[model samples]
Target: MSRIVERVRRVRFTWTHLAALVIALLVAAPLYWMAVSSFKGKDEIGANPPTVFADHPTWDNYREAFADNNFGTYLLNSVLVSVIATILVLSLSSFAGYALARLPLRGKAPIMVALLMISLFPTIALAAPLFLLMRDVGWLNSYQGLIIVYTALNVPFAVWILRNFFLGIPKEMEEVAWVDGASPVRTVLTVILPQARPGMFTAAIFTFTACWTEFLIALTLNTADRYRTMPVGLALFGSQFTVPYGTIFAAATVSVLPIALLVLVFRRAVVSGLTAGAVKG
Candidate 1:
């Protein structure tokens, strides 16, 4: 019986590993194809057979991508908007979350539910109203406009996540801060926030990712080339009659670099934050 159980366990482990490998390949295949396509020339990219491997890999695609479009400008815009949006969302959400978690407030549950419901509505639904509002406020084609929209879009999730995470933290810490004559603001900044790093990290990462990849809002808000983010700028690679596959692939590969770097740098923090939040709350 013992031998049989051990054999079954080994078999299960083998199957699990195989399943994981297959899933990883599926997830990675599109990215792998994009990277490979970026290295290929236009002719090779548009080959009849759709070659998996480039026959003659060249740097022309990347060169043409930069030469054809304002790639640098787009990249800078995306970085700025994403960073600012992330900061604002995190700051505002943290304050809201702390209040909801610690303060004596009426209708907190209903407020949270309402926020969640609002977030559930599709972005497309809000696009028209938002565009009108931004235009009226003379915020069109502005970094601040995009940042404000992104922050508003992401805050609900941040509040929900951070609020629960805050609740998991011991209230005794805040009590100690109060006993030390710390005001609510001072207690939040010094005592509570330090302990809530994981939640904040998680919220920041989510907000940044959302803002970085957001295309529709950016496109609608910013008609000017200077204000366009990577997603919108990428759309300009293809012409009216024909698509530039090589340039598109190359541009996409470049656009992914910042997000890839972010993941590499913050993987540990993200994992820890997610795990802590999940377990604690």
Candidate 2:
């Protein structure tokens, strides 16, 4: 009977592992196809029997994309806007999160609810209002407009992440800092903030990804050719008559590299941040 039970447990574990592996493959399939198609020649991309792997991988799509399509400019703009916006989000969210987590303020519950509701509001609904506001401020077609909007959109989520992470930290740490004659700001800067690095990194990564891939906002606000982002420019790769699949795929693959590298490098921190937020004192 013991051996029968052990056998059943082993079979159950195998089936569970198989299910996880299948899910991973399903998630990875689209990314794999995009990356593979990037290297395939134009003819192969459109072939009815889609090539899973390129028989003759070529660099022409990447070359022509950057050279003729202004993809480099778009990439640069995305990087600048994403990095700047992520910095703003982390700085602002860190403070707001710490406050929300630690301080006893009037109407805190209402404020938290409002923030969560605002985040749930669809981006499409804000398009018209945001465009008008940017136009009135003369911020259309500029970097700051994009940066500011991205920061606002991402702050609520970042604040939530950091707030939960902060809650999990020992409350006595703040009291000890106060006993040492540290001002609240100094305590946050020197003692508490350093310990919140994992949460901060998680916020930074998420904010950067949102800014980097944002399309509707980037399109509506930034009209100048030089200021276009990766998503906007990728759309233009296909003309009215011709849609170049290879070129689009190449650009997409290139665009995914930075985010992939970021995740790979700080994956552990991200996991820690996410899991740490799951518990609170």
User: What is the C-alpha lDDT profile of model 2 across 1-281, one tens digit per residue?
Assistant: 99999999999999999999999899899999999998989889988888888999999989878998999999999999999999999999899999999998888888888888987889999999999999999999999999999999999989888988998888899899999999999988998889999998898898899898899999999889999999999987878898888889899999999999999999999999999877652
TM-score of each: 0.92, 0.95
> In model 2, which runs have C-alpha deviations exceeding 4 angstroms?
1-9
lDDT of 1 by residue, 104-209 (tens): 9999989989989977879998889999999999999999999999989999999987888888889899899899999999998999889888788878888888
lDDT, each prediction: 0.88, 0.91
Candidate 1 Cα lDDT to native: 0.88
Clashes of 1: 0
